[model samples]
Target chain A: MNKKITKQIKELVIARLEIMPNNMKVSIGSYGAFSKDDLKRHVEDEDEIGKKVVEVQMAFLRAIKEGKLYPQE
Target chain B: MPKRMLVTLPDHDITTYYLRAWGKKAVKYAEDHSIEVTSLDRDKANRKNVESYLSNLPFGMVFLNGHGDENTVQGYNNEPIIIAGKNESKLKSTITYAISCSSAMNLGDASIKAGAICYVGYAQDFMFTLDESNSTHPLEDKLAGLFLEHTNIFMSAIAKGSSVSEAYDKAKGSLRESIMVAESSGNRTILSWLLWDYYAFVAKGDISSRL
Candidate 1:
């Protein structure tokens, strides 16, 4: 993973996760644990450590195109 | 008589805790509708016990909650309860609904081919957001509910005699509506994860089959 690309991806995913109400955490099975702090840690870590954050971010974008969210306003 | 609904609820970690909390509603709904509910909760949600229950009982539907992969549905402590090549046949003649990561990609298909009437699950990771402040009370976590309630609704629909396809449709519809609500509320952050859940959802084999 390119360090620069990893940094950019980490910032993007974390920003998205920050949309959750304060005191909430996101859990992505088989990818990362439940704590937002843990997710941030993963995103800031090396490519191998933070790959899931990038994967999930990409999946989220893909879902948007697939219209899985429906009525994408 | 209503058919039996066998549910595996494992509560060993944060992930399983949310599942267990959401499964409560499903269990209550099953019982309220006079559907026989057999639960393998906590430590009871192990491979040996699950196999024993299936072998000894007559269940029309099976609900699994745990960590899993494309080829397995696990139980307490991530023990494999139903594996693609091993005990997938035990699901023969039942409608199986798994609330686990990536099991639907392969295990769902394997179960159907091995004899299951139908299979419903996520082809990829099953994701959710929880309120850490309400972590002790997962059921009361509204953020988590935005994700888990849909899965519970699917199981509830099945227990209430809806066809497999109908339940699947109902769940997907619920997901869409939830996303809309989230969007209207300006909650864009979790929207993608919610959509990811919706996209990963899958119902295969015997779509018309019902419990």
Candidate 2:
């Protein structure tokens, strides 16, 4: 929730999005379809769409950390 | 009595264009299984038409494909069709699957309270990646299929007489399989988005209900 953590998460999200193929576009519901560059810009701006992207990234990280993404024993 | 389904396909933008194309599979599956389908497509996917059909028909299931928020799902050109506290009652006696963003957060609950048999949708943004080369032919875009295919699986399961809970479990299973594929492919973009959708997917009301 802090600004420093927020900036870090945004950087992480942008880095993850950068790996997307050039021909691929991500559609985030009504917020519209976004290219890799577009997603990076959204993360940098921290606007509504950017915030949502960050939230998603955070959720993924948490899931991994909690082993929720792993097969349950 | 034969099962009946009502679908709203609103294609006015890039996001909706893909939804409309992929949503057709569910419609087709229903018809092939002897379920009568009433398709309100494009401009016809408006509030007036949805209300008229639901109020006067015996549709047991409704598939809504479009942009939406926590309180409302839009139709063609983003015209609000079902709004929580306003038209949620129209969903009564129907199993509703809204392949839109965030409507499950509130509208799903409202519809259930209004007597809907079941409501399945995403509690957050329904995200997917599209192949721009296949933009003109969305159904051919395999990248988008990673997400939308699970939606089709859910509807198809329901048409096959699976209970709402069983259909939801099958869709979740499909998403898990895709997530494993994305992980093995080392595609962080796909993996992240698939995980997001997996967590956001929700089913409210009576999960035991069937069409």
Candidate 3:
């Protein structure tokens, strides 16, 4: 199968869900586990990870709504 | 055929926490799918470790769980940054499945610029609902099963020569469908499954040629 650019655009749409300021980097997590395989060869699980992103977005939105901050690039 | 290895990673914020949800699930799912799986917990392992592992492996799929910001993916070993570059054709080109958000956001164009097959997890963070049940099995029932479910579906789709998008949508959508139907909002079990299911993803691309 071909590596599709459409896949990234699809993820970009999801990235839009993040209402974060440009400088404010959204921190994810470090699931403590071990791997022998090279880290370079990983396929992203967008849908599942995207779910948590939505919640983070929700949090971002809540922060904005409270006038805590605003969204930037 | 080389043995399959499932590599699990951690995002930034949660990497410090000790939990088997990420690592154990990879093993269980891989076993179910006849793939040999292992995890690289945060700080304990790193890219060098992966290099060693890759050197010994025959060939298979690679699954990553961690914090994927923009162009680079943050792995363990105390913020070991893994850059996705022209190495797509390198390391025998193993297909990747990232459990972190945004790894595939630009269609993996940034990281896989050279050429690679990867399924990245993209979506809003709210999508992953943690298991709050506070019970014994934190993974066996939900996490491992969730990955296994889509993995099986993805293999089926790939066998058909389906495009990456087609296969991803097929497997992802189906995973969503099953979660919606289950709708058991009991303690941590179903809720956590529902939450996590909404986030993760499996990238499309036949990296086997590279490997």
Candidate 4:
């Protein structure tokens, strides 16, 4: 809900997404499509939908922070 | 009599695009094995056509490729084709597989309770990375293939008469191998989403049930 908090989360998600090979396209089923660059723009924009995308990204980030969302093995 | 199969593949955007293209693998397998396949693609994948086909056909396996949630699976234009607690019975007596988002969380359970033999899908958001360079050609997208191919393999396994448990295991195993391959290759981004998808993949109901 906080714009500053949302911006910080967006940057974090983009940082993670940036590690992929540029050829990759990340898809969240039917929500929307994103190339790496598209992902950056989608997550950082001030639009209502962009805020929701930030929220979703934050959830993934929170899971990662909690550990075990992605196993090392 | 050869068994019948119902396939719904709607082409709308990136996610649906991959599904529509990869679904042909299952369709081809069914045809080669003499399984009667009823395809509902594009606009034909709407609610009315889906309901009509299921109600009129004696299909044994149903594969749906679209977007969905815990309680519903959408078709062309995101129209709800199967809404939990409303028409899950349409899947009665059939083995169902949905390569959608989160329908397995609730719709899968509801359908089984409504009498489906088995339901296979992801419980949470189904994530996959596509190769934009392969936009005009989805099946060749290696990144997307890493995710979608497993589902196709599952469908093919079922078409070849493997039990639901066997097919599910085969798909999950493939996903696990892909994850390892991606990780070893220094690909950090996709591996996490793939692992998430692997964890989300689940099959409910008669595990021994075969199509």
Candidate 5:
């Protein structure tokens, strides 16, 4: 929420997206498909799509932290 | 009485292109099962055609594939076909499955309130990764398959006489399996998106409703 935290998350998301293969593209509903470099640019710009990607990555990290990805019986 | 199904596939852009290609599998499964299918494809996937079909036909299942938001599902060239407050009543008595983004949040609820037997869709953005090399041949893209195949499984289960809840469970189960596969293969990109989709999938109205 803070400016410092926001910048940190942006960097984290960009780093995660950077490892994606160049040939792959992500289609996010009406936002259309985005390539690896395109995603990094979005994150760097902190546009709507960039915020969305950051939200997705944050949600994923939270899920993992809560052990929701693989719940025990 | 014979069962009937209606599907809309709008192929005006790259995103819709993949949706149209994958949506064909559901249409084919319906045809193969002797279910009468009325597909509004390409330019025909408009509000007028969708209204005419729903108003006159007794289709038990409807599959809408295109771009969408919380209140509307677009058709050809992003034409609003089914708007929540305006035409959701047209879905009454039908089991509707929308493979678009975020329509499940509002339109799905509106349709159910308008008497739709059931509704299944994503509450948030329906995201997927595509292999650009297979852009010209979407069905052959294994990366995209990790996401779209679960949707196909849901529609196929419905066509096979599975109840709405049953079909939803089957799709979720398949997604979980795919997630495990992605993790085992150390594909974090695929795993993250798969998890996002799995969480986004939601169903409303009567879960026991079946075609």
Candidate 6:
């Protein structure tokens, strides 16, 4: 994807992550460590943030398969 | 003619926001339009309910609005899948419309294998009404006019007994952004919304029933 598209994807992933119910247990290990104030001091690229989104999404998928996210239906 | 529907909502309002919202009016509205809707919450959708519903000749339309997991679909009663004896068989072509968040993803393949005609739901997370002022996310909106708007145009075909796919396509076309499911890459959870449409896919059935 282009740089701009990747940036938008990051924003979208963040929005999806924020809505996951507590049952989904979405945690951004490193991203979580980033402080709001620190965000202003550092320049992060879309590709950098994009990695976290994939990790979180995979975590949720694995959680689902393992019966953590949404148990059997 | 009134079609019977086992309409279910969530036991808790948060996880099943779509159920909670649809219950607030969809049940009543469907009834007013002569749809024979049987409403239930998660607690009441027990074993008997699921078994009975599944065993019968398929209801023309199956409307589910609740929280779902890999092992069970939380209805007014909690119903888990029962493994029949090896030789026993199940249908693989029932049509379903799920307002549940992950019901489609968790149960999509299984439902199809078990004879579901078409399945619609959020592959990743929960679906929402247009709650524009939602405190939690910018995607939500106050969908006060949603049902009204949908019923007149989008849902008209379904109300007229058009097949599930027809109604679904009509509904989807009318609300592109609303039903799109964004496909996510196994990467960082960066701006993913633009990556996939929330209601992106429509798995169709073989040519048998017109609906």
Per-residue alpha-carbon lDDT of candidate 1 for residues A1-73, written as tens digits (9 for 90 to 100): 4544455666887787555566767787844445666666676664543565567677777767875547432
**How accurate locally is residue B26 in candidate 3, as Cα lDDT from 0 to 100?**
37
Every model's TM-score: 0.91, 0.96, 0.52, 0.88, 0.96, 0.53
B120-140: candidate 6 lDDT, tens digit per residue: 554643322233244243113
- Identify the CAPRI category of the predicted complex in candidate 4: acceptable
Q: Candidate 1's residue-wise lDDT over B42-89, tens digit each?
A: 989999988998889888889999989899998998889999999999
Model 4 C-alpha RMSD vs. true structure (Å) is 3.0
Q: Could you tell which candidate, 1 or 6, scores higher by TM-score? A: 1
Q: Candidate order by TM-score, highest to lowest?
A: 5, 2, 1, 4, 6, 3
lDDT of 3: 0.44
Candidates arranged by DockQ, highest first: 2, 5, 1, 4, 6, 3
Q: Which regions of candidate 5 are displaced past 4 Å?
A: A1-5, A71-73
TM-score of 3: 0.52
Q: In order, what DockQ does each candidate have?
A: 0.54, 0.68, 0.05, 0.46, 0.66, 0.07
Q: List each model's interface RMSD.
A: 3.2, 2.2, 12.6, 3.4, 2.0, 12.1
Best by TM-score: 5
lDDT of 6 by residue, A1-73 (tens): 2334355544544555554332222212112223222221222344544453444444554554664431211
Q: Estimate the lDDT of model 4.
A: 0.82
Worst 10 residues of 6 chain B by lDDT: B82-91
The number of clashing residue pairs in each candidate reads: 0, 0, 80, 1, 0, 68
Residue B102 lDDT, candidate 2, scale 0-100:
94
Higher-DockQ candidate among 1 and 6? Answer: 1
lDDT of 1 at A63: 66
What is the DockQ of the complex in model 2?
0.68
Error of 1 at A27 (Å): 1.5
Better of 2 and 4 by TM-score: 2
lDDT of 5 by residue, B35-93 (tens): 89999999999999999999998888889999999999999999999999999999999
Indicate the residue-level lDDT of B21 in model 3: 52
Give the DockQ of candidate 5: 0.66
Q: Residue B203 of candidate 3: its Cα lDDT?
A: 51
